[model samples]
Target: MRATSRFLLIGLASLALAAPVSGQRSDDQILPKSAELQKQGRALYSAGKLTEAEDLFETALAVDPRNRGAFVDLARVAEKQHLFGKAIRMTNKALQLEPNDADAIAIQGEAMVELGAVARAQQNLQKLQTICRQGCPQVAQLSAAITRGPTVASAKTPETPKTN
Candidate 1:
């Protein structure tokens, strides 16, 4: 399994240098190096190097300003760092660029849950769950968190419930 994973990693690294998609305007084209940097940023994010990931993501954005992936990535790193306002801002920026972005919506929804905006989080989660055609497993986790959070935080006992 380790060898197979290594081989797949090398193969993906090679493919990261492939040409940009057609129909992308010249200004919107993501160069191979930027794509590689973005991939590296994601790896760093997954490894919990939020500061390093944010730096690499910013570098990728400097190379390609219109990269929605960078914005989503930045939001996630910020969220991991507990910078909810920054996360929310970045998520909003990503949504403006790609309004139907399930990933961005999900990120915002998760952030809202943390920020105690229960109803708003529920609304965004609902939107994400609806359009998430291919079974968003992460959204499932978020759904569980949202449902469990209040139950855990709420006091179950009533003040007048003492029985004689």
Candidate 2:
């Protein structure tokens, strides 16, 4: 009986091990509901309703964590709010979902420039160049952002009150 039980346990273990592992969904496999939310967010964004757009983008991400486009849209809203760090982080999430995503790379580079990380932005620009040898719009966008340089506020120092 003991031997039979041990054999059964081994068989069960083997069966469990043999079960197919679920692989990650591809970048294009976002759920329809999530995609719809992302579309609504984009329309709101275009309408200049950044807060509403950001909420919709966040909801889209909640619906499907793999929605890279929603992450990119959130990054755009963060950029509009002058939240460069948040934008970079959001773009990083999108990049993780699709490493070669041109929009994510370009947005990240732009945020880096806003944060005065010109060197890092240049690296992103170079990466975009390599990814889109045929010359995509992302390449031009990042290139123009690099040329435009960091914002004046990023370079300015806070004025200290005069000491008596």
TM for candidate 1 is: 0.69
Q: Write the per-residue lDDT of candidate 1 for residues 72-141, one digit (tens) a residue.
A: 9999998877787788888898888788788888788777777788798888878877888676865786
Most accurate candidate by lDDT: 2
Model 2, which residues run further than 4 Å from truth?
1-20, 23-27, 152-164
Model 2 worst lDDT window (10 residues): 18-27
Q: lDDT of model 1 at residue 36?
A: 84
Model 2 deviation from native, Cα RMSD in Å: 3.8
Q: How far is candidate 1 from the true structure (C-alpha RMSD, Å)?
A: 16.6
After TM-score superposition, what is the CA distance of residue 12 in candidate 1 from its true location, in Å? Answer: 47
| Per-residue lDDT of model 2, residues 6-101, tens digit only | 999999998877665445566689999999999999999999999999999999999999999999999999999989999999999999989999
User: Could you tell me the TM-score of candidate 2?
Assistant: 0.83
